[model samples]
Target: MKILFALISTVLAGGVRYIFEVANGLKDKGHDVKIVALAGDHSWFKNLRAEVIYKPLNLNTFSSIVYAFYKFYRYVTLRSAKRNPYDTFLLISSKLGVRPDIIIELAELIRSFDSDVTVATYYLTAFSVWFSQNKNPFYLMQDFPELVEGNEGKLGLNMFYHSLKLPFSFITVSSYAKQLIVENNPTAKVTIAHPGVDLNIFRPRKANSQNQKYYGNIKGV
Candidate 1:
């Protein structure tokens, strides 16, 4: 099975680890997985076994005019590069080749790739792909911030919770959170992945007798 996973929380504390493990498990099952990411969220998983696709374009946040302007600038620059002309860069679903009709554009990019199952735990990250794609979408809902102070921009997260009201099979992180989702959406289905840590990399870090730095500033520090 080919799976497409898209999200913004890959920048969160446990986001990269969760994505990596999920992708790793899927690959172990002999499945092809495609991951779409914005910001620097996918850095840790770039070398992972599954195929990772990135658009390198960020969406706009209604934080302020400056942020909005920066998003526009980046979008236009990406368009000129002839990578995608959705009037914005397609982060995950350029294969869709159509404008994002949903709340967020990046979601559409991911879904456009024509994967069998698309999973998103973040709301707006799931919106675009499920909105445009004709494939089955699986959303893994873990965190929904009530208020984001200095966390990150309100680009995708806020949109998912507010603007998009799409149907999805939700996989919640906790039982309490699952009840909350059902209370909010009676028809929404919830499943838990019972998260765990990978023992392979969780072992103690052995210190080396000698240490080297990549740069002078790093070396001095």
Candidate 2:
């Protein structure tokens, strides 16, 4: 199957790492996988199998010009600079030749890719995927974004909560995550797909003497 994973950017983060793992695994299984994002940076992991599409903003375009002004206003008005919005920072960076596109244009770009399955890695991209395609896109719920925002008054909190209400398959990496989604939208079709571990890299360390003694007394090990 042709699979597309949509994310805000390929910046270093736990959620971004999970998306990369999923894309690489899907590619290894002989499926065509592509990562579509607003921008990509080589600060963290790199992709060898899946195609990485980095659609950075083109400032010369009319849409980008308008977006720049809008972002500027948001940056000035926002109480905290940290929450000034990512697109605003992207404008400041202004790296050339990345072929960045606006979020509004994502629907057409995603439709053109003709992917059989689309996975949205965040609430923002979930809306983008929904606008691009009415069905078949999976919302990979990593966590309750509102809690991370730490403020119910934040616009992001509302948007993140509303995204769950959309008619799309919800895929959570753990049962706890699925519970969070169901709590938000009781009618959500949720599924649990646990993440894989690399045994070569991660293994339980031999229990130390204290741990062994405790376990031995408790279970006669």
**Model 2 regions more than 4 Å off:** 60-102, 146-153, 205-221
Q: What is the lDDT of residue 2 in candidate 1?
A: 82
- lDDT, residue 38, candidate 1: 53
Every model: Cα RMSD to truth = 10.1, 8.1
Error of 2 at 66 (Å): 13
What C-alpha root-mean-square deviation, in Å, does candidate 2 show against the real structure?
8.1
Clashes of each: 9, 3
Candidate 1: TM-score? 0.61
Residue 215, model 2: Cα distance from true site in angstroms: 16
Give one digit per residue, the lDDT tens place, for model 1 in 1-221: 88888864355357567767789888989998877765444455545787666554443553245445556776687753332332233343333433234345566567468788888756656666566564787777766555331232454345545522467777776887677677667888778776776678688777654543345457688
Error of 2 at 193 (Å): 1.5
Stretches > 4 Å off in candidate 1: 9-12, 45-47, 58-103, 147-165, 200-221
